[model samples]
Target: MEGTEKPVSALGIEKDLNDWLSVTKSRNGTWWHSAFHNVSAMVGAGILGLPYALSELGWGPGVTLMVLSWVVTLYTMWQMIEMHEMVPGKRLDRYHELGQAAFGEKLGLWIVVPLQMMVQAATDIAFMITGGKCLKKFHDTVCPNCKDIKTTYFIMVYASVQFVLSHLPSFNSIIAVSIAASVMSLSYSAIAWMTCIHKGVIPDVDYSPRSTTTAGMVFSFFSAVGDVSFAFAGHNVILEIQASIPSTPGKPSKKPMWKGAFFSYIVVFLCYFPVAIFGYWAFGNKVEDNVLLSLEKPRWLVAAANMFVVIHVVGSYQVFAIPFFDMVESFLVKKIHFRPTKSLRFITRNLYVAFTMFIGMTFPFFGAIIGFFGGFFFAPTSFFLPCIIWLVVYKPRRFSLSWFTNWFCIIFGVILMTLGPVGGLRQIIVQAKQYKFYS
Candidate 1:
């Protein structure tokens, strides 16, 4: 806000840029359905690791950080929507287009596209990893003596399922999948929460520092920051989710977008806190990266929850990935002169899913992958970009509260990017030593 740029409208680039945004095309849907879609996208594999994440800092610091992430993400969601609203005659469908509109083509092309792709790619990989590992766990419980199902094989199998379902032509066609994914998410969350309660709080759990020395303590703190930040890294999907809400013909309806998103955030918050807290309380510091994995007996319920997770991730991956697929498809058509056809969409999306699954096979440790993406990639996509767009577009006065908050977002994002990646990389390195490819 302290330093604003010349408005894009004045440069007459508005009409030219509308080409990209129009691809997302405004669609009509009920607020609740849109809310369900948002919730579905937000509550994927992230929640599975949330307990371990929260347990890192104990309840107080953990809950505090979770709330802070929610607030900041919420504000940024509004900021992105505001930018879309300002472009009076356009449908700024996705994040990169928003960047292109607000900042310039270079950021949209070089920075936003790649960074956002990295985040989504990481997310899909995490999904594949989660699905594979969950299946492997199920296999182990049902038959201990049988040959272990490899994570890579399970991931490939799940990827095949996605390849079939991914044929749905557009975001509008995926509505049913979204609702199903949301319901499954809620089911597993409730099961996990109840399971934690039944298991009861672990006894004599140490809430003190995991590290003795100051340096070690700082490392632990930074690692915890990365882990916790991973729980709330769904910011990239918001603009697309917001764009899907039905608009009135003459005037876009902000009501549906706000109402839907707010309701969904409520759902997200309610589920996130209890699962994180109670799961930690139940398992203590011994919790696995996936809290569901922490459960020993009651094998049936855990299996059921894992089953739900697998199904949900399949759907969730598509929602998170379709935008990236759209981006790639657009680039191919524009730059490479490929025809935009239904067959091309089918090939591109399936290919993208296959590539992510391959990455998952290589990096099977889900927790570390989550931290890496959330730290390095999502920090800016989630926090920094929205603030920049808001500051530049709104031009809040220097030294004013809004300006400070905007700057704070930028600074906080930078700190998270720097410290978070360090923490995340540390996790990846630590986990890598124990990792077995396709195990």
Candidate 2:
């Protein structure tokens, strides 16, 4: 009877469209794919802000926060990988799917989807601004005598690339892009810190707080934590990355996924630590929010670094955007019951890219946006959500190490999520007073 029944209902149709448009449809990714994808996902525009974050927090607190974030986020990332295939034969292909497994269906969607969407969207917006800014930097350095161009035009050029690439379907389709982005991330990160070391420490550098008032110091500390939190933000894309790998009953995707994630974290450490420490050492409290902006003397090297940043952000943009495209297409096809066609995807994705570009052009507060969104949504998704999901699903023993660890992360993340915005908002307001939109 069941075999005789038609799989032609509205629900069945929705499922089919979702599968067709889903970013995880191509399950051919390998461990190396995971490695580079993770790298591209984690090491983007945020790493450039580490020195500025250190400047705000000073030596002790800055180092402590960076170290703590690395350890905690890695542990949480491992938890996500392990839990990916925990349900005997089922794979939690999306972050929201895992959330649904931990919490009941509607509640899970409510909690995870909004946070995950915000994190992905915010990162894309940040990348747009970063790519545009770096492009402007490259232009300025190479042709100092050339007439100046507004940053808005550069940002539009950056978004135009995405409009073309966004047509690439599935996570695996963009492997080449992600790989190139990953390499560029490592390359530019090296250039940033190495250039700083070459420049040497500034004369009579001040290591004290940037702000004199106690309130200002405290707020900057909060914003600095947000900056550090922003640096380790690959967790949002982990499940989607894992979904692109093949899995079977004998050899689940988690094994290769974990291997890739482990090695990626090593790369993450290599990229993040040196940039924060050495850049801070070189510039002290006077370092620009974007370290690339601070290094001016060696024109050619700085120009190359800026170009590398442009390429890296261009590649990294898709790593975050694919999931977003999936979300948009799924909504249009499933909820609206629209037919899945190439035309539908082209229009939707192009519009999304244009929207982000417009926003980036409007409010290009690179550092403030990083700190605000990093704490506002990135904190929950990257820092503590995995731990919370672990406890909810696994019910780790009371007073056990797992229990204590999860709780500690939850507490720390909540504090970051709460206070990070306060500082970031104040900074944005201060910057806004001096900024002219689309100028």
Candidate 3:
């Protein structure tokens, strides 16, 4: 505390700016913070879409995707840690600033801003849509009168939850939300496990589908890696965690932050892997949008899972919304010299919620939205941007493609970025065609 930075006053623009700076510097998140961030982002959207992904790629490829995603995520996370070392004092909010600092304004705007905004916004949309679906499910089951409710109604409900949660006055409250979400996640995992055992379904090791071609096998492999990436996509929160923790460089506070991230990720994998394997084994061809849906759990457990899914989904949107708000506030304050009054903040936040909800209502199919965004947007955000940023900023010496691991990650990331979007777009087009016919 003696050497740590002092808090800034909440007065003039200078003070506000200084406050932001101080907050970022002193921001240090706990294990709960990191775990919640990761789970909130990855679990909600990915779980809903995993069974569909399995249906297309089969069990072999589906499991492969989860494994590969973990590997890429681990490597990217390591790169982020390295990036932190290179620029010790900067937060992710300063990515464009750092870009401008290292390169120039033109490059930062043309490359960094657009890429960051696109990926972030796309991911935000995915979470919003998933949240909406969860709400619709919750309402149908809990409020029988709401059985025939429109997607817009569900979207409104989801957005309302997000708006309130996002405006929580303290970090402790956010952690509380995270703790609740983790319990929910674990409960759902338990329900899934119980359902599988109750049905007398044995775990199958020969889960991989026989490939028709070399290309098919390759695609299946990439799909598996993408699944892993989905679970690991919350590395964006690393900066937030770093800021939330008490920074004493070589202190215990720092140890927990790092150790917690590692441990929490392991827990995440444990929860996710079994769900993937068992869900595939249980349902095989009939696996629904969510593998949880494939489970013949008790009605109460199903209801609880649905409720938790909604909470998890909304919580994720709140986390992603912060960076968007930060960007908007920074632009207005710096460019127009306009301070965010309470009214303006409320309007801006609601407007964002509205836009996300509108998109969700327009496309209510949970599986389609997740696949499209996961492949088209989340892939770039999780894999491409960080890699590109690192390659540009650090320009690591001795680039060796000959090394197996190096070549594997580079090739894998490139493939995911390239094909993930293509597959996603194709799915979207097919859904659009189907919707046109149905409507």
Give per-residue CA lDDT, model 2, range 331-386, as digits (tens): 78767977889889889888889989988999887547678888898999988999
* Cα lDDT, model 3, residue 66: 69
Give TM-scores for every candidate, taking all chains together and pairing residue i with residue i: 0.90, 0.96, 0.81
In model 3, which runs have C-alpha deviations exceeding 4 angstroms?
Answer: 1-15, 18-28, 88-105, 142-147, 169-173, 200-231, 249-255, 391-407, 436-439
> Model 3, range 1-439, lDDT digits (tens) per residue?
6756554543355545634422242354665676665565455466544544665577565667667777677666555544553556543334455446455778765655665565556667777766666666666666666538665676777777777875653333466676666666766666665575576543452345434566655554444434444545676455444445554545534455566566666767767777766666666655675765554446566777777777666666665566566566667667887665666567776787777766666765634544444555456556656666666675656555424444466667677766665555554564675652101
- By TM-score, the better pick of 1 and 3 is 1
Would you list the C-alpha lDDT of every candidate in the order shown? 0.76, 0.89, 0.59
Best by TM-score: 2
Colliding residue pairs in candidate 1: none
Q: Candidate 1: where is the Cα deviation over 4 Å?
A: 1-26, 143-146, 211-214
Distance from true position, residue 237, model 1, in Å?
1.9
Instruction: Give the per-residue lDDT of model 1 (tens digit) for 57-101.
Output: 667877887888888877777777667667766667778778877
Model 1 lDDT, residue 246, Cα: 60
Evaluated against the true structure, the overall lDDT of model 1 is 0.76
